[model samples]
Target: MKIAVAGKGGTGKTLVAGGLAYLLARAGYTTLAIDADSAPNLGFLLGLSSRDEGAIVPVSKNEALIAAKTGTAYPGVYSLNFTVDDVVLKYAVPTPAGVHLLVMGTVASMGAGCTCPANSVIRALLRHLIVDRDEAVVLDMEAGVEHLGRGTAEGVDMMLVISDANRQSLAIAGRIARLAQDAGIPHIALIGNRIVDAGQEQVLRGFAKDRELVVTGMIPFDPAVVRAGIDGNSIATLEGSAALCAIGGILSRIDQEIKERLNGRVDTEKHS
Candidate 1:
């Protein structure tokens, strides 16, 4: 299953992504967790030490690799069809929590109408991961869906728009849903984070209903999560965490959705 988690800044989307990836890995799936955010904190949430996090060179900033794959031609020339199949094995950092992480930093702009080498490599690598890889892939994306083009979006099985019970957050979630739909993402659902009460849940459900989106899950506001963040500890290490429990349910729903899709396909084949 290929999933993308996105939300407005400070909505705990990274936490959702990390938790889902951890759960999937623990369930015996080989998971690749990609940090596609500009300010990458999935490493921290995934329990990577500060030193290990610092050691990770984001693909977008790796000049030599980018040049090697995209060529050194300036002004008007570069290879758009470069191979990035080995990038995961070559660059992914395996965490003790059992997920392989690949950080794709933000691409630098080279004026207008020029596709930078870093972007080219990142796009190719993402395509390979989403379309070719058999493992469960989770992308912790930026606030917007800018990194996901139509081709890449189509390959994703689901996009979970995480949001809090706030107007601005819900508004952004609506925008993200529309953008993901425009990019051909088939399933888009809302995951409510930091929901404190029934009122908060109602707010999220109402917003999702208004936007014609599904509310797949709701994660309550857990003090353990805040404490972990403050202590620079991994939330996954908190055994029996309420937030984690909620996320596990969400993952189960996602798994069931995948199975339903496969069963639907099989039924269609049998009928045909």
Candidate 2:
């Protein structure tokens, strides 16, 4: 399963992405967690040490590697097709919990102007990871789906738009869902995070119901999560924490959905 997690700043989307990846890895799935955010903090949440995090040079910033894959000469002229199969093996840092992390910093040329070599390399690598890789890939994306082109978005199985109880966060989530839909992403769901009480849950449910959005899961506000973040510790390590338990529930739901889809496909084939 290829999943993309997105949310406005301070929404704890990174935590969710890291937790999901950890869960998949712990379940014996080869998981690749890609940090596609501009200010990538998934590394920290995934329990990478400061030195290890600093050692990771994002694909977008690796000028030499980008040039080698894309082109050397002109700015606009570059190869759009490049092999990125070795990227995971070569660059991905293995965590103690068995998840491989690939930090994809923001695609610089994606802002304005023609696509540059960096953009080509980043896009190609992302496409390869999402479309070709068999492992469970989790992308911790930027606030928006700006990095997701039509082709990349189509390859993703699900897009989880996380939101707090705040109006601005929900608005961003709605915008992200629309963008994902426009880009041909098949499944889009909202994850309510930091939901403190019944009132917050009701607000999220009401928002989803009114907007016709799918609420995949809700995570209760846990002080343990906050402490973990403050202490620069991995929440996944706190196995019995309320937030971790909630994330496990979400992962189970996702796994069940995947199983159902696979079973449906097998049944259809048998009938045919």
Predicted structure 2, TM vs. truth: 0.94
| 1-272 per-residue lDDT for model 1 (tens digits) | 99999999999999999999999999999999999999998998888999999999999998888878988457557888778988998999998778999999986532233377787787778888999889999999987777766688899999999999999998898998998888789999999999999999999999989889999999999999999989998856766999999999999999999899999999999999
For each candidate, what is the lDDT? 0.89, 0.86
Q: Model 2: which residue pairs collide?
A: none
Candidate 1 matches the true fold with a TM-score of 0.95
Candidate 1 lDDT score relative to the true structure: 0.89
The TM-score values for the models, in the order shown, are 0.95, 0.94
- Model 1 deviation from the true structure expressed as Cα RMSD, one decimal place: 2.0
Q: What would the per-residue lDDT of candidate 2 be over residues 175-207, giving only the tens digit for each residue? A: 888887877888888999999899999988898
Over the full model, what C-alpha lDDT does candidate 2 score relative to the true structure? 0.86
How does residue 272 of candidate 1 score in lDDT?
100
Deviation in Å, model 2, residue 168 alpha carbon: 1.0
Regions of model 1 farther than 4 Å from truth: 72-76, 108-114
Using TM-score as the measure, the top candidate is 1
The RMSD of every model to the true structure, in order and in angstroms, is 2.0, 1.8
Clashes of each: 0, 0
